[model samples]
Target: MSASVERWLTLEGLSNVRDVGGLPLRGGGTTRGGVLLRSESLHFCTPGDVEHLVDVFGLKLVLDLRTRREIERDGPTAVARAGVETVALTFIPEDGRELPETDGVDPLVHIYLGYLRNRPDNVVAAVRRLAAVDAGPALVHCAAGKDRTGTLVALVLDAVGVERDAVVADYALSGEQIEAMFRRWTTASGEPMPADLTPHIPRAAAMAEVLATLDAEHGTDGAGGAAGWLLAHGLDEADLEHLRKRLTESS
Candidate 1:
């Protein structure tokens, strides 16, 4: 991994917390630092961790992609108590709720595609919220910061012309953190890992396939591309431009 891309923060109570910056853009420049971050749940963050995020990292917005039930069950996050604005934009509708059975696909892939098919508006809204953040950095996250978070981050990076491979690479990085995350969960909950959740491991090839599908659905580059697809769905042009400026460095 490139040094520029390995900017993980060592927080007292968080894991997989890293800045999504310094990624090489398609043309030449790298992503700007301290604007966008992706992480696992902040529900367990201590006061010091909150200080690091607010004072040191300048995190002003917490975009929680976990479902309503997850938030209620987990209670308040450190960010919320620290006065950082936290927005709940669940990527999966009726998440944790009982649903009709559907077969013929990898369950993980099915859930991933469900984010796009079931509630694309939420996805667009999440990006819009990130783009609208003006006070400081925005941290987006889900329960484990892998699937839902990865999908949204991929789209945001794609919208700004970050190389598709680089986006997939970033997504793949989440796989490196899964074992640690599982340990944390098991320790916290005092329960063995559930059989159903075991198969949801992150894979680079899965993300690669997603990007390929995205490119097939929308043009891979230029104005009428992935970003355009977001615009068509709900994201504003100005907001997209703001995100591009916030995340990308000048060449």
Candidate 2:
């Protein structure tokens, strides 16, 4: 749908980097390209990849959603070393708080809901920072660019009125690249991905459910929508407006 969108970026070292743009909105228009990108960790980006991000793509900000332990384990990202402003906002608690056990929900879905329930403040802060990026494009990334990155990107796209299916499709795109991602991760870390976590790959239905839950908890319109969800958490209206303007292209 909507020409399928330009979803992937082929950098030398990264396998999961993508431009979150060109998706059709509800009424009309498409998401503006180059404003928002989502990716896996940039810890292994090559020098050319760093230049491509900074000089060609104008990457001005990087929102790293990795935990302190993960960052320390992976080391610094090339984007940060290249002098881009990088912000670390942990989406999951590092304090050992466990997700509520829910019967019958997919484990991945449960963990996603846990992010919203457990760390609304951090989620809100991430959106506010993305909204404030006026100098150049902003890249948001987590370990695999699947869970934490997916949730935040979904919220941002939904807040800007991108169709639910489009957002879900974008989330599911990561599933297509999982093998390549695993290879990159293993090569970089010299450790195999845990066997127990292998089954929780990105699924379209999972994101669809996430949006449905958000709509149920927050009103579909008015102060109950995605923008309202952020507002209730702590983001100001100006930042919300800035986000909508920055991401959406007119019909």
Candidate 3:
């Protein structure tokens, strides 16, 4: 991995920022550094944070997966103010309440699955931008950067032929940061902390179930998984190929 690429970025106002790089690719090599990133909301990013992302990361695009309501409540983020092109593409609603309750299902898992079944168009659009050649050093973020961002990043990684276990491990990293994120939000907003953060923390099993479900439902000859879902929804073969080439390089 390049010294310039950090697995975790300790920005002034963000807790869950990370470069989605340095993971082992399926056949060989690793994902390219500084090409892709994921994070929690940029809503509270300090000016220094913005400069670091822009100057150091050479960030060009921000794919925000937060609902418009969330943005209305808590943005325009410092990063956006710094002039990086930011696009809002929501994956699901603010919470999982709109989804029908299922017996014996983890609500988070149900919500993650709903993102795929309920909102395929948004998913394709986000993936398209990530695959675009000019979308240099892009970051995808939602409020918590766990559910919506996690699901989308998982799809991108899986589509790019990142190992499945690596994909799940990447998703699970958010769990480690989520508590601190909530606390930071509380400190910033002056709101009382929630008594329990269980609902907000990600469960590795949820992601595992989601990917396994994708493979079972969308897989062609047991291989397609996320790539198949993207193709079925609207992304073309060329975009998938471009995504692989764009995000990965020889180690």
Give the CA lDDT, 0 to 100, for residue 232 in model 3: 91
On TM-score, who's better, 2 or 3? 3
Ranking by lDDT: 3, 2, 1
lDDT of 3 at 158: 89
TM-score each candidate.
Answer: 0.90, 0.92, 0.93
User: lDDT (0-100) at residue 221 of candidate 3?
Assistant: 67
lDDT of each: 0.82, 0.85, 0.88
lDDT of 2: 0.85
Whole-model lDDT, model 3: 0.88
Stretch of 10 with least lDDT, candidate 2: 219-228
| Residue 155 Cα positional deviation in candidate 2, in Å, after optimal superposition | 0.2
Which candidate should be chosen as best, given TM-score against the real structure? 3
Q: Which pairs clash in the backbone of model 1?
A: none
Give the candidate number with the greatest lDDT. Answer: 3
Worst ten in a row by lDDT for model 1: 219-228
lDDT of 3 by residue, 16-79 (tens): 9898888888888899878988999898788899999999999999999988888898858888
RMSD of 2: 2.3
Model 2 Cα shift for residue 230 (angstroms): 1.2
Clashing pairs in 3: none
